[model samples]
Target chain A: MDALKAMWETVPPATPDDLARARRRLIEEMGGRRRLITVPRLLVAAAAAAAVVIPLINGLGTPAYAVTKNPDGTITVTVNELRDPAGLEAELRSVGIKADVSFLAPHTRCAGPRFAGVDPSYGTRPHTEAELKWGAEHWRSLQVIKAIPAGHRIGIHPEYIRPDETLVLEIRDDQNPKVLWTLGAWLAEAGTPVKPCTPVKD
Target chain B: MTSQVDADDATLIGRSLDDPEVFAALFDRHAPLLHRYAARRLGPSEAEDVVADTFLAAFQRRGDYDRGRPDARPWLYGIASNLIGKRRRAETALYRAYIRSGVHPAEIPGAQVEDRLDTLAVNRPLARALLALKPADRDVLLLVAWAELSYQEVAAALAIPPGTVASRLNRARIQIRHALEEGD
Candidate 1:
């Protein structure tokens, strides 16, 4: 046993480069948070001016997004006063999510959010009535119909959301805007155990 | 550069929430020993993957870490052990290869005549014994013998009762002793 221990100890130690590579990997994983710290700090300082000033120059078509956690174990994401969709896309990027939002005129009927289904490798699959019903019944189902405001319209489709994840999205009407509705979607992945919804405060 | 090197694992893990690089100190302290242990079982290439994966996973789950445990060796080793378990086939193959070649690639063969002969005789049988033992028993025995973890530490690492570790150790030791005797 002692000899075995000694023999094992003789194995080569990891080189400095190897350690550096690992540290690099960790930094890569932290890319989102780092951007949040830097970009948002600047954006927040400019937000007041941008909120009031940008509207005059950019017009009322730019979209701004704020993600917040509600007391009811739900997420409230307000995509408001949109002038350009790029700002909303950037905010989603800060949170390590890729999303696209397009605003249409009032009363324009829009399609629902697209999902990659359970198997992205096989390509997109349409949600069946039973599947849609099951998704709705699931605790994390995204409340699409309810979250959209009465006058303002948008289509939401999740191309990729990990399994055992619930995505909560809230959208409000342009007039007297308040978080009137929310969608909770519990995404199920194949061969993975369902995870309970973890309320995320954005 | 950070004074965090002096801080205990629990403290480092707690501080990691605010300053992530603080956790790197923990990796610096533990990774070499972890790499050595994993290399013993899975060789150097796989050991690199195991060590990297262990630290990355540890960093991610630091939020859920039990801060009461000051020394993080057991927790870290436990994570490494789980990763090692996933590559059990590789581990068994390593032992089988050692038995066939009577050469442990990582080991520097002994210089003296008697030491070299003795090592050759014992290493093959040890490799055979390790191969023959159940995974659980081998884990307990190797952790005690090679990693030098105490019975209590072994219990903590494997998340088993101390009594269970003792029983596994006893059973493994008997088999190893018998294997050595047969070699003699």
Candidate 2:
């Protein structure tokens, strides 16, 4: 057993080029962009409300999201149901987080922005013909950006937002055949702190 | 100044959330060993695929990584193990080829001429034993014996309990011993 282990260790490693190529591919796929400013204050406020609710559409037929300006200089957007992603984006922009929202479908059968590489092992099975057809025409525009595998509804790569730029996000339905249910929001300006709402004296 | 090398995998993965290129530092740290391990199981060509697939999968799932565990070896090895399992036939074929020709493609040439015969004598029986074991047993046994992962680490890698790891290792060792005795 010891000799076998030694022999196995003796095997040559991957070439330097292979390493470089793989790294490059990952960077490209993960969106070759810098980190988005993390608003810890907003995350704390929103975390509690982050839950998956079925029948995304509210009874009133309006988009389902709660956008509030936190006491800390950040805006909290808790997405309960993804009826309209663009509506949520509008809500965020009104609070001043210049953000763009897109829902990332769980199945990649859709046509959208091309990433350099994707983990083939991840995600559910391939899309059906009907779903693939829907994704083809609506992929770039469908609402959900975050997939269930991501374990949250925040968005795909929200960190890519630049201090001076707008934030673009993609969310996805967690259920199988995860589709874009809403076009959340697109905040025009990012990095600037949201003003705390004036405190109301009781 | 904390160089990337000085940082742990967890920290590196965290940094990657911001400056993704920083994630490449992780590849530099572990890809070599990972490639070697894969090459041992499968040949160099498939090993290359295994290395690429492992890191890429890890990169995508970096957000879900357990930061509590500072070392990424078990996680990385775990991902690589799955990819290698998909190519089980290739792995078995490599071992069978080595048994037949007594030549491993990745083996260093002309060195250890004296130890070559002894290494082959043991490796042949070891390969047969490995081939004969059930997939689960093979995973447990190789992770410990070949990857040098501890029982606890194997549990983390295979997502099994440590006690289960011990039982599987015991069973695998017994099978290997019996196989070697038969060869004798």
Candidate 3:
């Protein structure tokens, strides 16, 4: 251990010239212009944006879902759930999309301006069939089919859905909206049917 | 100097963009250590690239730096580790070559005969032990031993929890000690 420590300590220090060259190279890379932003501030800004946007827009009840285009030009659907999160989670599992869900409160607002121009007041509403349908319509218009809840809300945020793939169903306690279940399955790339979520028993 | 060191990584990063001198300072502070670490894993030839790539990436991503930490070595090392991971074949080959040739690419200059031999003996076994460890564990171990980073610094570099750092270090140390004892 002492030898190891000594060895580490004895390692040659960087010379002033080495630093100068590094600075020169960095300056060249910057096109002879030094950067104006610091990394931490940038990270803070990014994190702030992600913290706000991801929860609000990407979280639950928004109209966008991730679509993965397969090598054969086919697309795969994924849904993100925020409302009735547990239910959507179980559904995702039945469909073989291993999902990990977290419950986020609707009132939990993040700092910064919201992107997508959708009103935050719209996000605060309770989950209703009309709202879900409206979300679906908007998502469809945007070419998104799969929906998942992003947080512990009443809305079903679109995660991802293929065009023709079947929806997996795993719902628990049909009578209680608070109950959690899951739905998952592979569907085709277009004109896929929106299946009703069936509740599962313990 | 303390203020400069105490300045958040973000502040330094911002300075780097407009001030060529600041970027050079950052590089001066980090490159030698990064180079030596890379040299240990990859020969001197590839080590330079790793160092260069690390600083370049840091430059590009300076805006995303977390200001909570002032020092940037951990972050730079993390980037270097990623670059090193991409060249896994070369790194493994270098270590295997070292084991065969009984030489460390980053061997210090003008070392005593016994010290050089000792380093070779310890490091050869250590290399094999390092090779045996999971990539994550090896990363933590080397950052501590070779890079001299604190556990918290290693966590920052790897974007892992400090608890994870402790566990990885413990596991890696066990393997290293075992390898040394076995004289492999």
CA displacement after TM-score superposition, residue A200 of candidate 3 (Å): 64
lDDT of 2 at B15: 64
Per-structure clash totals for the candidates? 23, 34, 59
lDDT of 2 at A42: 29
DockQ of each candidate, alpha-carbon based: 0.12, 0.29, 0.11
Q: Write the per-residue lDDT of candidate 3 for residues A16-94, one digit (tens) a residue.
A: 4534455445545653231111112223244454432222224435543333444543334343433455555555555
Score each candidate by Cα lDDT: 0.58, 0.61, 0.54
Which of candidates 2 and 3 is the stronger one according to DockQ? Answer: 2
Task: Please identify model 1 stretches exceeding 4 Å from their true place.
Answer: A18-20, A35-202, B1-5, B108-114
Off by over 4 Å in 3: A1-11, A14-24, A32-202, B1-10, B17-21
Task: Give the range of the ten consecutive residues with the poorest summed lDDT in model 2 chain A.
Answer: A116-125
Model 1 scores a TM of: 0.56
Query: Which runs in model 2 stand beyond 4 Å of their true positions?
Result: A32-34, A38-202, B3-5
Q: Give the per-residue lDDT digits (tens) of candidate 2, residues A55-135.
A: 333577544777767565444556666556578768877766565455444322223222211111111122233333232
Q: How would you encode candidate 1's per-residue C-alpha lDDT over A82-154 as one tens digit per residue?
A: 4454566566555544444443332221232233224111112322333322321231223221233332233
Q: By DockQ, rank the candidates, best first.
A: 2, 1, 3
lDDT tens readout by residue for model 1, B51-140? 889888988898988899989988888899999999999999888888887666655555577876777787788888889999999889
RMSD of 2: 12.7
